[model samples]
Target: MARRYDPDRRTRIIDAALRVIVADGIAGLSHRSVAAEADVPLGSTTYHFGSLDELLTAALRRSNENFAQALRDSEVCAGDADGGEGASSGARLADELTRVLGEWFAGERGAIELEYELYLAALRRPALRPVAAEWTTSAVELLSTRTDPATARALVALMDGVCLQVLLTGSAFDAEYTREMLTRVVDGCA
Candidate 1:
């Protein structure tokens, strides 16, 4: 009798690849590793992803989509008050962003690390640049709803810097400090 095929095998392989990337970085990613992580045969990974680059691309795309969804689901700017630029609205935006960042750091720090790994990997691989670009573009688009394009771009950069600092220092994420910085940016944009 033939073996059963899992309909979600591709997704499982992609997710397992992300876990491997998070734990070992892109340098350690391989069909065998992902297969073991996913508890699937090695062939499954190769069948789903013909090469390591393809697997990395899929994993990065999945990771970006998951992070983007988390940002969207947080309703980061859903409470934006309609009217002229006011301190209250700016503060509200900052508070919302702070909350979102806090939650992300508290729960998704590993994923954030994986994201940075993929971003750095893109630096050497020209083909992977599009994945990183898409991730940045998505984040900026999400942020633009709360501020001007230039400020939104700055805020995204700020976010990356802060997250990297926290990750590197292994210190607790300072949401208040983030809020303060975000408020400064939002107020400046107003």
Candidate 2:
């Protein structure tokens, strides 16, 4: 065969990389591993990704977009932005945040952990910082419409902490507690 044409090869590779990361953590990723996971030739991975960092950057960026889309797609959260009708006491916003967190935690825990692993990987991989930040900025921008940017940042931080806590400690996600805590923040700002 002279050459094979696969339009979605790059995407498949990135998706495969995600799966590998999810299964083995970022530490276990490598061109050989991704090629095996993608079922493509090793050269294909290198051709598509000049370096492991480049490949990670692509995977993290795609993962970030997925998370951003989740927030963008949530009607419940959107409704609370801008205080819904008139002025909001932050209850609705808090409720929305709590609900969103509940849904996130309810999702496949491994995938969530993998996403955070990619984010935390930024600590060592400077190339991934922008990709990780994109998720935060996207979340903040979405939340900013409901409240000031400062409050939005605070909310993001709180959500991150709660999410990490749940993941690290293997504890149950308490929706009521989350709602109350978020409400206090929103209420204080209100």
Q: Using lDDT as the measure, which candidate wins?
A: 2
| Poorest stretch of ten by lDDT in candidate 1 | 77-86
For 1-190, candidate 2 gives per-residue lDDT tens digits of 6799999999999999999999999989999999999999999999999999999999998888766777777754465445446636587888777877788888898878888899899999999999888889989998887788888888889888988998899999999988888887867734
lDDT of every predicted structure (CA atoms): 0.83, 0.86
Considering summed lDDT, which 10 consecutive residues are worst modelled in model 2? 75-84
Q: Root-mean-square deviation of each candidate, in angstroms?
A: 2.7, 2.5
How many steric clashes between backbone atoms does each model show? 0, 0
lDDT of 1 by residue, 106-149 (tens): 78677888887887788888777899899889988988887788
Q: How close is every model to the real structure, measured as TM-score?
A: 0.87, 0.92
lDDT for residue 116 in candidate 1, whole number 0-100: 77
Candidate 2: where is the Cα deviation over 4 Å?
A: 80-89
Pairs of colliding residues, candidate 1? none
